[model samples]
Target: MSIAVITGASSGMGEEFARRLIAEKDGFPGAPFDEIWLIARSEEKLTSLSEELDPKRCRVVPLDLTSADGIARLSSLLSEKAPQVGLLINSAGMGKAGAFASQSLKDVESTVTLNCTALSEVTHVVLPYMTSYGDTLPKKNGPRIINIASSAGFLPQPDFALYAATKSFVITLSRALNQEVKPHNVTVTCVCPGPCDTNFIKVSKNDPNATFTGFKAKFVTTVDKLIPASLRAAKKGRSMLVFGFGQKMLHLASKILPTNLILFFERNMK
Candidate 1:
């Protein structure tokens, strides 16, 4: 089965990835693993996209991946749908921005649940099926796993401490997993994107720091740029896909500068 399973497919990079696969045809065409699964908390939105994506080839399962029951249901679906899963995109994530001391406990908890726990659990369910399972299975490409991290994770977080820390964990874990899974014919890629124009802003609305007060939103690219880049990274066998020049600079700075100087910028970013 050439099945490519995507989570957080309702919007942003996940949605773009789905469209790219569908349009590219070879990767996700109208047949085979061409089947697309849209997972999110909103069924209405997912259903609409599924229909647009072609009902015969697309399926939607409403899920709140933050919950254990939701994760189990998704796991069950995976077992029933593609017993030999091909690609997994872990794009389900939310953002929070604020003074850590002033943020709500709920925000912190939910971020960990969806961004950290859900991503990891989905990886666990998808990995085994992605491997070469005793030959009788139809021949196809091995599984590719993409974790949506953020450029924010490259350095110490300021107001949005937990969100950055969680992303950092994803980047770290994905790289290590990539090394281990290489021998198993599996690829793990961590995509660290800088400031994209998505629900990220609305999600972080409660936090004053998210306003990006003086910055131009136009500088941020649409989710479309990320999908192709992500796939290219996967094809090249790279473990890291850090997007945008600003992000690259920050990542570089974090490495070259003294800890105190980098920490200063992180803490003082207004």
Candidate 2:
């Protein structure tokens, strides 16, 4: 069976991606996804989403990817079934906004594990199962991978130091992995979306009053706007996608702006 595996599918962009895939299957010609493996930490939310989707096509795997056992479980399943991976969305991540010095060791470690380690492990395990190889160069086809990196990945953010650094790793991995998998006809896209109207703020434990301030406030993207744009960019086999015109301009700025100058401005903003 062919399948699309999405992490962080309980809420936010991951959940929206699942919904859009089912709704837009006809939009993608030759889409062969007969099943969707929804992986998330929340069993309740996963159960609810499964009920909403086609029961026969949706399989909920409620496991915390940060845990070694959870990662092993998914790896075993993939090895056993060896399903054709049509798409893989590495959207599972966590962050907390605060001074790095003041953060708990647990919180810092969790952020690094979930945002970077787990994502890398999942992608590595799934690559062998993707049905992207062919006799000819595959154009606009899967298996495809989308890693949900943050706009913060582009620059240093003082209050969000750990999160920003982890996302940077994600962006780098996505770009490099794209080249590595290209010969196999696989496409990897890194999505850099700004703040969105999602529960991420709460999940990240951002201070309510200071959550979206300064330039970040102006470029807050909605799930409705962000997911489709990301999906479209990935389908086109783009290496990186920064959502919204404002965010796009920001990405460009990161490339042109001097490192010290950008750091100075971000430090003042925080």
Candidate 3:
């Protein structure tokens, strides 16, 4: 059986991907799959989402990838199913917005665990189940992995230091893994988007009223725009996708400008 495995599938970009894949509403050609696996910590949310979509086609797997047990459970499920995973979107992540030292030990560790460690673990577990190029599956239907990174990863941020660093790890890992998997006909696309109007902000800042403003606010995007574009990029087998024009420029600036200069500007941007 062919399946699409989406982590963080209960909400935000992950939820959007599941909806688009099921509805096929986005202009991008949707991949055919016998099942779409919705994975997240909230079983209730996942079940609700599965019912909202076609439950028969959606399998809800509630998993807290930050913990070892969660990863083990996922691995066991994949082994038992042994399905040909046609698509894997690792959208599970967390971030804490504050000075590095001000953050609690738990928060700091959780961010790293979810955003970096879990992502890497989940990807490796799923790779074995992904369809290979020579598996008689049509090339157009070849397996694809979309990893949700951040434009913040292009450079360091003063207040959001750890989040940016972890995302940098994501960008580097995805790029290198793409090269390794290219020969197998499995493409890995890293999506680096700027700020978005999602639950992410509230959760990161630990405040419902928290949001981007002034210069930073201009770059905020919606999943409605980001997810579809990312899917298209994945279909085309692009290695990296910087979602917005502004974010693209930012990505370029990180490459051309000196790091100290960029950090200076970022520090004074407020």
lDDT of 2 by residue, 1-270 (tens): 778899999998999999888765643323546888999999999889989987678789999988879999999999888777778999988888778998899999889999999999999888887744321334655567899998889988788899999999999998998898887778888999889978788767655544565677777778998898988997887898888887787789899999788889777765
User: Top TM-score: which candidate number?
Assistant: 3
The residue pairs that clash in candidate 2, if any, are: none
* Residue-by-residue lDDT tens digits, candidate 1, 11-33: 87888877776655444211246
Ranking by TM-score: 3, 2, 1
RMSD of each: 3.0, 2.1, 2.0
Compared with the true structure, what per-residue lDDT tens digits does model 3 show for residues 63-88?
98988799999999988988788789
lDDT of 1: 0.76
TM-score of 1: 0.90
Off by over 4 Å in 1: 27-32, 133-141, 206-211, 215-219, 267-269
Candidate of highest lDDT? 3
Backbone clashes for every candidate come to: 0, 0, 0
lDDT of each: 0.76, 0.83, 0.88
